[model samples]
Every structure is written in structure tokens, then in C-alpha cells.
Target: MRFNRSSCDKCLDVCPVKAIWIDDQGLHIDRDACTGCMLCNSICPADGLSIQNFNFQSVLAKLKDLQSPVLSCHVVADNQAHIKIPCLGLLSETHLAVMSILAEAPVQLNLTACKKCVNGVVVNKLQKSLFAVAAKLMNGSAPKIKLIEEKADLHFRPISYTRRGFFDALRHMDFPETIGYSGGLPAGDKPKAYADKAVPDKIKMLNKILPMLPETLKNWVYENYYYHLRVDSNCDLCLSCVMICPTGALKIGGDGSTGKIVFSSAFCNGCNLCAEFCSKNSIDIIKGFSGKNPSAYASCEAAT
Candidate 1:
């Protein structure tokens, strides 16, 4: 996965197993535990993570030469001698569910070992989430999906840490304290609320009167610093964006009227998270009103 340091952790969210992690040295992939499943590229919000792409026809021809049968799967395996596909974030829960029904052989996913990957967060997410979804569909039974990390005796090449750090800083100029991937919440059945609704007057008047509301709610109403974008015209009003926003900023609300995407910048950290993964390309990242210069946070925010 190619990740800008600002929010490279996108890979950490998809792993079926908790094989991906970050530290002062940066992201690491535990090759021994990774299940080469390319799920990380599928779910990454940045569309940065990817696996080596193997042409399906070529792979099929090679399998024929080996006298082995083709493997039918909804997921792809990560290997070095493969084509370049963006991170495993491309896959979804439905893809995993379908794999459970189509394949019969014990499935194996070959992924990067710790030493071989610069983008460990992306690889790790692919492993964990695949396992979680597989377990649910298989009723706790072993999934056809299996994890395997690749081993390559390669040497570390030196590069300028200063240059890397500089560019990373630029991308994260407006980011929050902690951005990228969600975890620690257990599954539940609570009914979720999407974009917050408001009466027609509330809709038209909120932006104009934002400075007049209570401090606590003022930012909430105007989405002060948080960046928001319109759902594409194709948006089925899926409300998925409402559900996935970590800050509880976007919500579905309206008056017998067409529902709208409401946002609260009070809780936003100026993370370009919502815009990164938007399938519709309707969102854009812009500066939020933090009442201070953006450089202040850029200088002070902790590095991941």
C-alpha cells in the first residue's frame, strides 16, 4: 500500500486478524500471521493500499502448467510477482460472504512479511477483518481463507528521513490528533442515526447564525473545522457515510422533507477522512474554522 503518513493507517482497519500495527518506526506487517488476503486495499479510505496484481489469464495458464486447478475466490492473494492493484480496501463484507459459498479448498492468502512491507497498516487490516467476516458467515467455523506472510531476505536501503518527514507533514497540515481506522467497539444491535436532520428554517438559517449559538453547539451546527461534501447525485442516500464518520458529525435528518447530510465540526479534527474514501468523488478537503492558524496544529500535533 502507498500511504501518505497523514492517514496511512487506513490499512489497519480491514485485517481479519490484528496483524497490522504502527510504532515510532512506522507501520509493520507480521508476516507470520498475515493471511495474504487483499482485503486491506478494498477498505482503505485513501485508495492507497494495494496488492501485486497477477493477470487472471496468466495465473490460470500457470496453474494449468502446474496441472493445478484454478482457485475460485472473491479475494486476491498478495504476492511479490503480481500486478499492482491498490490496497485490499477494494473488497467488502459482501465479497467475503460470497467466498464462503463458492470455494471448497482451504484458501490461502500470501502477503508481505514485516521486513518486506513499508505499508504494514494496510496489510494488517486485510487480515483481521477478513477473519471477522469469515467467522460470522461460517458460524465460527474455519474459513476457507488462510493467512500467510511472505519471506524475502532483502536488505534495508537508506533514504532521507528528513524529506519523508517533510512531505508527510504537509499532507497532515489539518489532520486530527488520531486519524485513520476504527476499532475497540464491539458489535451491537443499536439502531444507528445517520445525517442529523433539521427543519427548513434550521437548514437555511444555521450557517448564518452559527456565531450566535452556544459555544458547545455552535461548532456542532456549522461543522466549524470538519470538511463535508455532498453525496453524489447517485447517492442512494445509503447513509453509509453518516454511519461511518468517526466523529458523530454527519447525521441523516429532515422534515418530511428530503433528508440531508448534516455535519458538526465541533468534534472534527479536520481529518480529510470522509473525502478520502468517498466513492462518488463528491467530497473535498478544505480548511475548517479552528479560530487559529493551521500551522499551530501542524507544529504541535503528534506524529503517528
Candidate 2:
């Protein structure tokens, strides 16, 4: 998450409305000011600060019913999409990739009305997320995407609802008590203490999606998403990585003698905390790891 306390303010940086910030009390969001453009959700490496949480099971169920699944932002969708989201900017590469895999067809994105919207920033973010999905595609072919950018497209914004109502219903929804703290409260209201316990949504999605990779593409997909950790004989068994890891991906296991590290690829969110905290420098992430620092991967091993 925060490699350093001052590092990794991605959600704060990407917000078009400048709705997010952090102070002594903790992170805060100007709820009323937040347009719910959702750029913050797809960009946060820690998977923190998602104002719109989707039920993927329901998404999948709907996806199966529509042979020609069309996805669009609420502004332009107007009953046109099988999946209508507040903004395409909120979608991560995992979302695009999963939908593509499930549909077994190009996932259509309606972008014809994007330039007309004040939230034009989402177009760029959506492009970048699509690019990320494309890179992991083993064939190095174009991503499974069909962009509906023609001006004549039938799926245009409707005038029934004003822009102000895009996410007005958020306050009335029955969600967790802490959900309201993400945004929509007065400036004086601070969020509850950071619940650093939940495994981010992206991590869960990655775990499930990897297993669905076709046999031929599976190895290449693993190289793109997972890492292998190596440990040298010099390890002190300090287990600092285990302590610092936000996800319990790394552990040490043994019967009676000669303990060795165990890594669960499913839980690793690619935070690379274990690589940074290793005092021995014995941890080396061999491949498939990318971070702010090229050198800080893991013990004699690769990062997952």
C-alpha cells in the first residue's frame, strides 16, 4: 500500500474533483463534491476508496444472458447496456479481461457520448485500462474490445436525469455503516479507522480469473500476474515480510526441521512488501514483478 507513509496517494491524485485527501485523523472524501467518476477505484494499487462497489456475481449473471453485451456509463447507457456503470473510468483491467473471457466475444464499450460529458477524463482512463488488458493477452493481438465511438451511435445520453443525479441514490442505499464514510458526509466527519483487513477486490478477481485461463494461455497469463519468490540459506526466519504483508500470501511452513517459505499466489496483491522488508536481502523476486522500485521484489525469489 504505502511503501512509505508519504508514498502511494494514487486515489488522491486521480480524482478529477479533488475529493480525496489524508490528514492526521485519516483519509477523507468530500462526499457531496465527489462526482463518483470512479477513477479512484481502478487506479488504487491497494484497492482502497471505492465509492461504487459492484456485485460481480450479478454482473456475470447478466453477462450470460446478453449475447451482444453492451456496457456503457449511466450517462449514455439509457437501458442500452447489459452492464451499466457510473463510469467506465472505474473499471480495472481485471474487469475488462474477465468480461472478455466470459463473453468469449469482444466486449463493446460505448464511448460515443464521452466527449460531451464533463467527465472526459474517464475516456483516457478507460483507454489505459484496456491497454493493460491487451498486454496480458498471450497472443499479443488487439484486446477483445469493440469501441462504439461513432457519433451516429444510437446509445446517446438521455435528458431525463440531470448530471447531478448520477450518484444521488448512494446516500439512501442500505450498505455497511462504514460505507457512508467513503464519501457523502460533511467536512467535519472523518472516516472510521482504516480497516486494513479486507483483501482488495482486484486480488480476489485475479485469483479466480487466473484459473479460468485457457490451457495454452495459462502459462503466459501466470507470468503476467504471478511471481515466484526465492529465499537463500542465509534467511534468519525473522518473518518480517509475513508481518508487513497486507495480504497473507507469504508464510513459513515445516514439519519438525528446515522451515521454508510458502507463498499462496491467490492472496498476493502484488504489493511486494515482503521484498522490501527482508533485512537479509535474501528475498529476490525472479520474474513477473513490477513496482515503483525495480530492485525491491522479494527474497532470493520472485514476487507473485
Candidate 3:
């Protein structure tokens, strides 16, 4: 979920409005300046920039009622039965993959007006990348989703929240009692803290979606969705990889006298940070995910 050492600036690169920025503490959104276009949310690999109101859960729930779901941004004219989002750029691979697995009919993304939109270029790229990854996961199986330019004519209706709904929301507010220092630390730190405490959203979504896929696709996803690490004979058991792993997928420990390194496939996002930091070139990343748990004991001399 978190890549502390990651120099990935995909979100920053995609924002057409320059409303998002990263500092020492991490990614920050200038909400007043942001139009809620959701370009950053779509491209963020860490699942970091989500709009509170338009989340995957809500989208999924909406899909349950429609046989053919069309997702469109506000700029587009509403279709008869489409689920409208703030921006098509908000839909990530996880969202598309999950929709494909759960929806009975093909999912259509209405991008009829994207070319004229200010965020068109990034939106186009995001959709293409998500489509490519989804197709790869399906092993060339016909994708049950599509991106197309088709306009529909319909009016938008605003949802009115009831008094009880408003009151319930008030009960769930997470407001701090007092304002403190605005910003100083890097935004990566928050994600790092979260990674230390919970599984990344991608992994969690993959686990849920895998079971629903066909057997071949399921196996393929399990095999290709993760990055596998191998320790060779050259490994000096320095345990540097363990310490460098951002997701805590790789861990090191000892029985006081003996040291060992263990890897949990569940946690690895395949960022290659561990392999990158290994000084001995001792770690090799297999392209596919491993079915077996990964563990290795340090050579006795290295443990000493």
C-alpha cells in the first residue's frame, strides 16, 4: 500500500489542474482548487487519493441493480441507466476488475466527451492502462468491459439526504478537537504507518476478486498479480531486504543465535524495493506469484 522509498509521481503527473502536490509528509490535495475531477485517484497505485463520497463500495452497490452499467462523468450527458461518477478518471483497475467479476453484463465506460475535457489526456491513458491490466489478468479472455465515446441525453437529479441520515453522519465525523501544525512531514509517512497496520487495498481487492474468477483466470491472477522473490546461494543473510521492504512483506528474525528471513506473498505489491536495495544482488524477483509461503534461514556464519 505504501512505498516509502518510491519515487512514483504518477498522480502528480496526471493532474491537469495542478491541485495535488507532494511534500515531505506525502500527497496533499488543494481541495478548494480541486474540482473533484478524480484524475489523481484513478492513477494512484497505493489507493491513496479516494473521494469520500464516490468509493468502490458505493459503485459496487449501485452495479447490483443494473444489468448493463454505464459509468460516466458529470460533464457527459446522463444515460438512462448509467451510474454517474464525478470523473471517469476515478475508476481504477481494481474497480474495473471487480465490476467485471461481479456484473452480469459488460461494463461500459462512457467517455464520449473526454477529448474535449481538460483532463482528457490523462483520463485516456488511465483507462488504457486499466484495460490492459484487466485483459492481462483475464489471460486474453474477452474483456467484459469497454471504453467508448457515446453520448446520452438525460437530466441529473440531486439526492436529498434525510434528517436522520444527516444526524447519523454527524455521529461518524472524525474531526479533531484542536487544530495543530498544518504540514511538515512527508505524505508517504501516513501511508507507511497504514501499511504497517493493514493490508494494501490492491491485495485486499485481489483476494476478494480471485475467488470469483474462472479457475484458469484465478490461477493466472494468483501467479501474475504478485512479485515473487528468491534468495540465491550468494545471499549473505544481511537482512537488508527485510528492513527495506516498504510493505513489510519481507521480515527478518532469529532464535537469538540464528537469523532467518521470511516473506508473505500476501503483503508484497511487487514494487521491487527490496530487490533494488539488496547490495549483494542476492534477491531475484520471479515474474509470477508463488503458491507456497517463502522462508529462508541465514547461513550460520552470517547469523553470528
Q: Which of the numbered candidates is closest to the native, going by highest TM-score?
A: 2
How many clashes (backbone N, Cα, C below 3 Å) per candidate? 46, 20, 9
Error of 1 at 198 (Å): 28
Candidate 3 local lDDT, 183-276, one digit each (tens): 2112333244433434456566676666557777666666656656677667777877777665667777567576566667667666676777
* Candidate 1 Cα outliers beyond 4 Å, as residue runs: 1-41, 44-84, 150-304
Q: Which of 1 and 2 is ahead in lDDT?
A: 2
Candidate 1 residues 1-304, lDDT tens each?
1212335565686566767777765456776666555555455432233332222223222223221122222233333322222233334443343343334443344454433444444445556657765554455666555544544322122223488886874463323111321212212233224333222211222233344445654443233323333444554456655555544546666644676555554334344656565566555445444442211112111112
Per-candidate TM-scores read: 0.28, 0.71, 0.67
Global local distance difference test of model 3:
0.60
Give the runs in model 3 whose Cα sits over 4 Å from its true position.
1-7, 12-39, 48-54, 74-82, 130-135, 139-141, 152-195, 233-244, 279-281, 292-304
Clashing pairs in 3: 24-185, 24-186, 25-185, 25-186, 25-187, 26-186, 26-187, 26-188, 223-289
Q: Is candidate 1 or candidate 3 better by lDDT?
A: 3
Most accurate candidate by lDDT: 2
Query: How many clashes does the backbone of model 3 have?
Result: 9
**How would the candidate models be sorted by lDDT, starting from the highest?**
2, 3, 1
For candidate 3, the 10 contiguous residues with the lowest summed lDDT are 176-185
lDDT of 2 at 84: 66
